[model samples]
Target: MDTNTKAFIGESATTFATEIGIVIRNDCPMNFHKWDLIPEAMKTILYEKLEGKFQLLRTNKAFMKYVDGRLHAQWVRTRGALSRHWKENGGKTYPQRARLQVHSNCWSQDDWDHVCDYWELEKPRVSMLIIFYK
Candidate 1:
């Protein structure tokens, strides 16, 4: 695998998934812990807006995985959590892009520029899926 791919789905991270549903949270606190601060005020409310438009599912499965072979969990799935949220709360607002930053020591300007282009061209539009290869 390339160094760039290792960054998103950690090489060793195990992934657990099923068509019924997938839970992304794993043993490492890095993911869940960081997500803890996501403001509950917006949780149930925001999903409501995304319904019909998309589904946020938390699963161990992804299009790709890192070297270690672990799958991370996701918070929502299609017609899943967010779809349900909007039904409850139809009044809410959303941000255009969700910015995520990471520090790396290997990538050059060209590599990063390419990654940015990929993010916009592919990843989901709601959260701005970004991949910065290290």
Candidate 2:
């Protein structure tokens, strides 16, 4: 990649890590109360973090993997808080609990197409398009 792209990814990754730490610290209590909302909340935070820069990293595979690794590591760091919440709620830790948390569903080809459509936003190449539309 070029220097600018490299710098952007590096800065974004650093910001993502810092934000994850702050989120875990401040939101642990709310998370404990609403276990089912965790995934959706995380997705929203990630989308917010990538808002202005999504066009930069959208087609970059290496950047995608870097982002995934950062999120996985942060999830690991916050596991203690999750476990504590479960324990306090009389939810015992078990192998099945982890499995249940990561439930997977089989999607048809059409569903996969929909997901791709949702993620792959194409920016207009011409300013005239924006000017005329706006």
Candidate 3:
């Protein structure tokens, strides 16, 4: 991938991870330590807020794995549409575009700060998603 596309991915991943962390912190605090224990309402909100708009199931799955403490799991799919775009584009960058996808279920910056303060945890990092390059 070109530098720009790589950078976009990095930035998006960070934002996506942050958003997911905030969701978990807000919706499933009672079960934060155990993803499987999260209630259906929490899972539904998370799925709609994250995957529904981004169409990145693999990336969402990776975040879930991270939350579950399953280390070194693949976060994004290498054999998927995103990968095909990179391979077919001859190392060029994707067309510059902005997607303003948001949902009512999202948390505000203040809420995120509260989560950090309450949980004594740091902000999410892009490194949490271990890309499995094939």
Candidate 4:
């Protein structure tokens, strides 16, 4: 991806990570689980957000697909970071886990909680473990 595209995806992913269901809807059944499952509304919003910086590129399908791919990669990295933070700081009790400091400036306490809740699920935990072991 171009520098401008990379920068935009990074910034937008941060906002999407932080806002979740507020700024953009969490269309996935499990909160923030899959990037491809992200709703068209959110993708449209990202495209609109990019309109100012990438006027001509905005209408390009290849450009949008590239942007979406980069966004997915960014989300994977964010999830890995969050997982690391959880393993390091999480406690036996939910309250203890919830009270831990947020992992990134992009995330609020509620966002952290939502992610933690998702990670608590068996599928996510197993998937992360596989990714970690790899």
- Each prediction's Cα lDDT score? 0.30, 0.44, 0.39, 0.55
TM-scores for all predictions: 0.19, 0.36, 0.32, 0.59
Q: Which candidate is the best by TM-score?
A: 4
Q: Per lDDT, what order, best first?
A: 4, 2, 3, 1
lDDT minimum window of 10 residues, candidate 2: 98-107
Query: Model 3 segments beyond 4 Å from truth?
Result: 1-8, 31-33, 58-134
RMSD of each: 18.9, 17.9, 17.8, 7.9
Model 2 residue 106 distance off true place after TM-score fit, in angstroms: 28
Alpha-carbon error at 85 in model 1, in Å?
27
Q: Residues 25-116, candidate 3, lDDT per residue (tens digit)?
A: 44533313334545667656656666543453345554454433421111122113222433343212322110122112324444323322
lDDT of 2 by residue, 4-107 (tens): 44424467556656765554444332322233445756655654555544443646667666555555566555554544433443333343343233211212
| Cα misplacement distance, residue 4 of candidate 4 (Å) | 17
Task: Estimate the lDDT of model 3.
Answer: 0.39
Order the candidates by TM-score, highest first: 4, 2, 3, 1
Error at 133, model 1, angstroms: 45
| Per-residue lDDT of candidate 4, residues 62-93 (tens digit) | 76676666556656666676667676776234
